[model samples]
Target chain A: MPEIANTAAKVAVAMTVNGRLVSAELDPRTLLVQFLREKLLLTGTHVGCDTSQCGACVVHVDGAAVKSCTMLAIQADGMSVTTIEGLAGASGLHPMQEAFREHHGLQCGFCTPGMIMTALDMVARLGPDLDEATIRENLDGNLCRCTGYHNIVKAIGAGAAAMGAGAKVAAE
Target chain B: MYAFDYQRPAALADAAALLKADPEAKILAGGQTLLPTLKQRLAQPTALVDLARLPGLSAIEKTAEGVAIGALVKHAAVATSDVVRAAIPALADLAGLIGDPAVRNRGTLGGSLANDDPTADYPAAVLALNATVVTDRRSIGAGDYFQGLFTTALEEGEIITRVDFPQVERAGYAKFRNPASRYAMAGVFVAKTADAVRVAVTGAGQSGVFLWEEAGDILASDFSPAALARLELDPADLMSDLHGSAEYRAQLVKAMAKRAVAKALA
Candidate 1:
């Protein structure tokens, strides 16, 4: 049998967030979204719904898109997490973010961060040549109260193309 | 989400010891359902033994029999795996029809089978395909594995290590999903082996997933969509809610079964 430890009020958690290694002591109940928004002040990841239905809290965990609201902060220990804040680098904006702006994908801009995060993960998995049906089907987790999905879909396609071109240029 | 001790044991023996020590301790696998249930205060576990660190439980391997999927394998992995798609395309298709891409990324096959949600899609496939539920303690056949809603043959401290699915001659699954939750309102899995046929219906059953022996018998002889045309399911044995009436679910079960049979034949 394994030695059992007394229950502690808080546990130490360390993880890589947006290319930087960070560590913290947190209550066991602290969710990943709460840790990101309240502790790190990376509030770009929204909480449109506390329930897991809304993709407003979507982020990339180890290069795969996952619902942040459904995962505990401790569960993400030692893993790498990429949030909306992580997208911009030396480049002014990510291709997906630029495409959203170019295509007028947002009215309230609440779901934009998650949309962009999910779009990037989609591009990573499905490649840059995404179709209308594929984008619509993959967007099942996300909900836009403004119902600006038409523009959102358009932005994802354009962004995917730009990302492909950017990768090509980088390779060249 | 009440306060609880969290442990990531490196070995299965240590994880089992943790669960044995605390009866209220829950094994956290992927946490897609448990975390949501915790947030709602629906369950109060004293500790969460995370299986993330446990090694050798996330692989999908093709075997001489069929395919053996590790318990910690996520839904997305199963849905996108070339091995699974080649061996059992129906299983791959079923995995793809789960909640969404994000949910699929975090949810696991072991987690789904352990929860045994009546509206889940895995139960149907597990039953229809005659898969084996392998745990730390014992190997349970699909016939003896599922008991009822949110119930399984798993004992306390018994962690499912993997599941072995036998390759069938042909199999297919179809479900009418609840628009809001995307859970199946009525789902059917039809499998045809060398000598036998199996039809498992989920979501519609009041008790849980069950084999439609009559439909299986009819298909065993005829093996076509038209073979199930004359069959009818009794509404009294089904579930009824705001989303659908018991009568509605009964009809859906037959319709989905027909579609599954057609897919298998196709």
Candidate 2:
């Protein structure tokens, strides 16, 4: 039997979530998704499969998107995490969020948060001028049960372009 | 997931000490595979020793022989790294092809190699490229490292530090992936060095990743896809499951090899 199973031992975890420094004493088995949804009440990130296959629990860790369900909260100590809630500012919805709305990229909206988070990471890494094939290929990890991927792909392409345009305006 | 002690050791020696102290301790690299298994209750580890805080295990440097990639180097880093692309573009391409963007961001070369999943992509590349697995204790050649499915020569408490891939003249990889899971149903990696041609096949082998010695011999002289038109792997040596039959995987291995060779020539 595992030793910790008998004890009420909890690990201390501290990290920056959505630009806010948060800390909690959590069980070592607590996943990052559990930390976000159950502990912090930041329930924007959904758990579609609870496995690594679906990207519904996708969130940014230290600037790179990762599946939160597969990572333990203790493992995320001292790291910075960003979820869908962090995407928008007082200025309004992020360009990617706006693009999803304009493109009707969602049906049930269950996978929207993950899609937007992954889209922003893609734009940050692959640049804003993403092609159709590139967008489809990059969406391999994220699955939409509503089968609304056609519009999701369309949204990502338009979102990428808008992000590029927004960057240009900021630079000027 | 079962409750377990989580220890983050800042130094390599400390990490090794922790593992040595607890026989049931498991090292956490990227946690891409281990965490999933734990969540499913397939493993009941007493403790998890995280290597995240350990330094000097995440560098990718170009050596005189080839490229030395730290074990903790993420798949995304290898895929986008200018150094890896210049040294071994096929490796970069293979890394890019793993899972999805989010997976690539967290999966590491060491984690993949250590787990030694039968359908994993890295084993084919490691074998074909003639890489060396460096550890805290000793260096292991690729030929002797992989034993079978989910198995390696690593002993308890040992940890992989980095992998040194010797530069090859030409190399390419191609895989027939299970569409839903994105794991290789049959994958082939072909490499031509200064003196020899090497071919490694993964996902199809019944015993795990293996070198198609006959294919390598034929390619050494001809070095073309047309030369392998008549070659066929015995179905008895390939895997069969709900995804594909042994005969189907046998055919896929040959087809994927041809495609990989063609890609190398291109």
Candidate 3:
């Protein structure tokens, strides 16, 4: 057998996830997706493709949306992390998630949560006025095998509208 | 994936020192390639130096000279950033056109250029922009950095910190993407500098990436796609793959070069 590298069973890592401080004992080789699923038990982040090609394991890392599958759990040490579960605030559901549900945005729902997270990031960047082509182009990262994306686009548009209306209601 | 030692050093120098000390260690940027390779068991580095946590490396700044994009900057940040877009809209376009959204969010300039995948979008534009890749140790020209398929001039433990692109007067990038993967089947970067013109063609060359010499010659004559198409790229030297044939890619090179030129001038 070849000589193996050092594999310390447990390493201490800290993270600020969704406005909360967290520390966990993690394996040296543990991936972020595995950590979310196994260690932290935050299973809203799904792992569809081991390769970064599939956006099923998407999350908001340090306020930017990134594919969680591609990252190591240790890579996120001392960082702020957010999963699909973090999208909803004190409110019942995130406008994007609500819009997704209202517009029949999910079919298998395997890719829905990540879709919502990625759309949240996109909405944060492009704002409520994102057009159809830009939405399609921006949504290219998330893959939904079940839904053909017709309703997903509508969901994003409606989500933006909902977000915009919320802002208006808050102003009043 | 096999177990491995991992380090995330805060300082850029500390990261470089770690690599310099360990020859077998690989630099992990964005994990767009390294993690996938690890999962597939194609690559198992004894140790990985994660560049993600390094500070002062992901800066996209504009000086009087041109734009300097940190190697650690993700493709999505590059695509969405107004600073990057204003300086090199073609670069933003190239960044957006790279793999789907997930890949863009996770892939960094250094990872793509370091991997030097022949079909990657950055290398073509990097060469076309005549960007200088700055490593912890040295600054390498775009021509020198790229050698061939899966090849680069980087030495062991050399970490690319940033890429400095000399702002061109007008530029346009066009790509005929592989439908499924979105990697450029054939892409062209056409720039109109004050002194002269530069045309770099990628994804269609067996030599990996080549300057369209004949196209440049035509552009020198008229500086238009219509003028450039008069001089055709030799299909014999082009790359033939599962995606496209040598002759067909050669034609696309001509067409894309023309479109890029038209877009730049427009």
Docking class of 2: medium
Candidate 2 residue-wise lDDT, B1-266, digit = tens: 77788898999999999999999889999999999999889998889999977899999999999999999999999999999999988999899888888989889999999999999999999999989999999999999999999999999999999999988999999999999888999989999987789999999998899999999999999999999999989999789999999999999999999999999998
Clashes of each: 0, 0, 1
Residue A135 lDDT, candidate 2, scale 0-100: 92
A43-135 per-residue lDDT for model 2 (tens digits) = 999999998888999999999999999999988899999999999989999989999999989989999999999999999888999998999
Interface DockQ of candidate 3: 0.56
Model 3 lDDT at residue B246: 94
The candidate with the higher DockQ, 1 or 2, is: 2
- Pick the winner on TM-score between candidates 1 and 2: 2
Q: Write the per-residue lDDT of candidate 3 for residues A1-172, one digit (tens) a residue.
A: 9776547556778887777888888766788888778877888889887677668888888877888888888888888998887778885988899999999999989998789888888878788777888888888778899889999999998998899889889999
Candidate with top TM-score is: 2
> In model 1, what is chain B's TM-score?
0.99
- Per-residue lDDT of B1-266 in model 3, one digit per residue for the tens? 77777787889988888988888778988887788788877877778888887888899999686899999999988988898889888889888888877677778998999998777888878888889999988999998988988889998888899999888888888999887777787999897787677899888888777788667666765788778745767899888988889999988998999999998888
* Model 2: how far residue B205 lies from native, Å: 0.8
Q: Candidate 3, clashing residue pairs?
A: A141-B101
Write out fnat for all predictions, comma-separated: 0.77, 0.81, 0.64
* Docking level for model 1: medium
